[model samples]
Target: MISATTILTFIGMATATYCSRILGYLLLANRVLSPRARAVMDVAPGCVLISVIAPHFVSSRPEEIAALAITLLAASRLSMFPTVVIAMTSLGVLKSVFN
Candidate 1:
């Protein structure tokens, strides 16, 4: 069973993530950004994604490495929702096959 602590942790993490994503938009809502600044903002999420997944590149497990490659490819070629779906599906399959 999930403990109360675990559930609260999940909630806290969710809130933090949501706030981080929205905070920048809120702060800049009244300002006009230059083209360069807009471009940087657009790619900020990808940078966050890279930071989260970069450590997995050093993983010794073949499944994890393969899944990361698949995720990178999907992220490059597809939208965020489809990329997440493909990444999750590929990781699940790769883990089962490798194990």
Candidate 2:
């Protein structure tokens, strides 16, 4: 069901993404990141994570908010796999009970 335009757009986007990454790697392959640059890179994931999650948290229901809090707490105490499982399970249970 994909139109030619849609297919071309997808290909264009994919090419752009790969080109950007390749360009970064090629340009920075031999360069050492400054301390500031390294620090920025280290915090980038957390900044992006907050940017992504903050909006959803703002709009979500109380049950979802509770689930998010529980997930955060679980994340602090547990590793990735257990945290993910707990978050998904809690969300599923909350959704089932509330909605």
Highest-scoring model, TM-score = 1
TM-score of each candidate structure, all chains considered together: 0.70, 0.51
Best by lDDT: 1
Positional deviation of 61 in candidate 1, in angstroms?
Answer: 1.0
Model 2 lDDT-worst window of ten: 44-53
Model 1 agreement with the true structure over 51-79: per-residue lDDT tens digits: 65688899999988999999999988997
Give candidate 1's TM-score.
0.70
Could you give candidate 2's per-residue lDDT for residues 1-99 as a string of tens digits?
A: 335674565355445544655665677789899999767654543443344346547855987788788878996897544755576567667766887
Candidate 2: list runs displaced more than 4 Å. Answer: 1-29, 75-86
The local lDDT score (0 to 100) that residue 22 gets in candidate 2 is: 62
TM-score of 2: 0.51
Candidate 2 structure lDDT: 0.62
Q: What is the lDDT of residue 75 in candidate 2?
A: 66
Give per-residue lDDT, candidate 1, residue 59. Answer: 98
Cα RMSD of predicted structure 2:
8.2
